[model samples]
Target chain A: GGIITQTPKFLIGQEGQKLTLKCQQNFNHDTMYWYRQDSGKGLRLIYYSITENDLQKGDLSEGYDASREKKSSFSLTVTSAQKNEMAVFLCASSRTGQDTQYFGPGTRLLVL
Target chain B: QQQVRQSPQSLTVWEGETAILNCSYEDSTFNYFPWYQQFPGEGPALLISIRSVSDKKEDGRFTIFFNKREKKLSLHITDSQPGDSATYFCAASLSNYNVLYFGSGTKLTVEP
Candidate 1:
């Protein structure tokens, strides 16, 4: 069994500010992903990493950047926060690219 | 464009009754389907899944019925309890590409 942990369960950012969300997993998985979930909307992929230091963009990668400095960690950064924006950022990992993904609790963000 | 779609934004069912949620996909290339359950303030978790090769998959009281010819699938929850109240999401992905395309989700409430 393994667990995924996300940091800063809640985040408050000002408009135009930069924010970073971190994720750590102990599953020793080879694939990691970042997704954004808006209210009443399905989750959208932001970025994914097939392995350490590798990155791939997704449908909603315009304003976000991701980093995979180590095999067990992945991070996402919001370049500039949007005013009144609120969403939940999720981190997930899978044993393989096509395998079932395990998700973290998530980090809720509110931009003022 | 939304590649996946779900019917009935919200549904209410009495305890011990059956709750059915429907989902459809636009991409026929998607061969993997997964259903996820999410409670408030938490990340979505994988509930059940089925491959395109199988028309039906069952786990305990949860059953997934797939119609490959129709590009649709349904989730049936029997003997639903209040604890089963949550948002359900249907997602699809290709065998080669591991990124999942998720439906908007259906919010289910089981009344006791």
Candidate 2:
């Protein structure tokens, strides 16, 4: 059994400000992913890492950057927060070639 | 373009009744399908899943019916309870690829 932890459950940022969210997992999964959830829009992949220091862009990776500092940690950075932007960022981990993914509690971001 | 789509954006059912959620995909190459359930202020969790080769998969009161020829799948919840109320997302991915394409989600409300 393992748990995924996300820091700062709530975030408030000014427009055009940069924000970073961190995630850590004890599952020792080889793949990590960051997803953005908007109201009624479900979850959209931002970025994913298959291994340490490996990054792959998803459909919604235009304004975000991700880092897989180690096998247990992954971080996402919002380059420039947009005004009135409100979304929940989720971090998930899974073993390579496996279909099941474990998710963190999520970080809710509000830009003013 | 969205690769996955869900019907009935919102649904309400009474306790002891059944709830049905529909999902479809555009990419024929997608071989794995997963359904995730998310409560308020939380990240999505895997509820049930079915592979293209399987026509059905069941876990307790949750069941997934898959139609590979139609590229469609449905989730059926029997004996709905208030605790079952949440947003359900349908996701598709290839067996070889780690990326998942998710639907917009269906918000189910079980009225007790």
Candidate 3:
């Protein structure tokens, strides 16, 4: 069994502030993804990496940047936080794109 | 436009009863469908999945019925339990593409 871990379970940011979220996976998977979850909205894809140093933008990557510096870790940065923006960011990993994905606990972000 | 859509934003059912969740998609290229279950404060987990080639899939008490013609699918949970209470999301993707498009989700509450 493998586990995906996300750091800083909760985050609080101010308007225009930059915030970062990190994720690590022990599954030795080849693919990693970042998604944002908002109330009453389905999970939206932010970014994904097929392997180390690879990056791809998704439907909702306008304000986010992602990195896969290492095969086991993926990180996301919020360029500028929005006022009163509250959402949960989730990280996931899969052995291959077509396989089942395992997710992390998630980081809850509250912008003031 | 949203590629995937789920009906009944929320549901309530008693123990031992069957709970059904519906999902539909707009893209004809999507050949894979997966259902995910998410608990409060946690990321979504893969519950079950089906391919467009298969009309139905069963795993323990959970079952997925797929209809290629309608571009729709449904998840049925039999003998529901309190532990089954969670938000369920339906996702669609092509076999060759790694990215998944997800529905908003259906919140299920099972009463004991």
Q: After superposition, which runs of candidate 1 have C-alpha atoms over 4 Å from their true positions? A: none
Q: Assess the local accuracy of residue A1 in candidate 1 as a C-alpha lDDT between 0 and 100.
A: 97
* Candidate 3 per-residue C-alpha lDDT over B1-112 given as tens digits, one digit per residue, 9 for 90 to 100: 9999999999999999999999999998899999999999889999999999999999999999999999999999999999999999999998747888999999999999
User: Each candidate: how many clashes?
Assistant: 0, 0, 0
Candidate 3 total steric clashes: 0
| Better candidate by DockQ, 1 or 2 | 2
Model 1 residue B102 lDDT score: 92
| Local accuracy by lDDT, each model | 0.95, 0.95, 0.95
lDDT of candidate 1 over B33-61, digit per residue (tens): 99999999888899999999999999999
Looking at model 3, residue A96 earns an lDDT score of 74
Give TM-scores of chain A for all candidates: 0.97, 0.99, 0.97
B-chain TM-score, candidate 1: 0.98
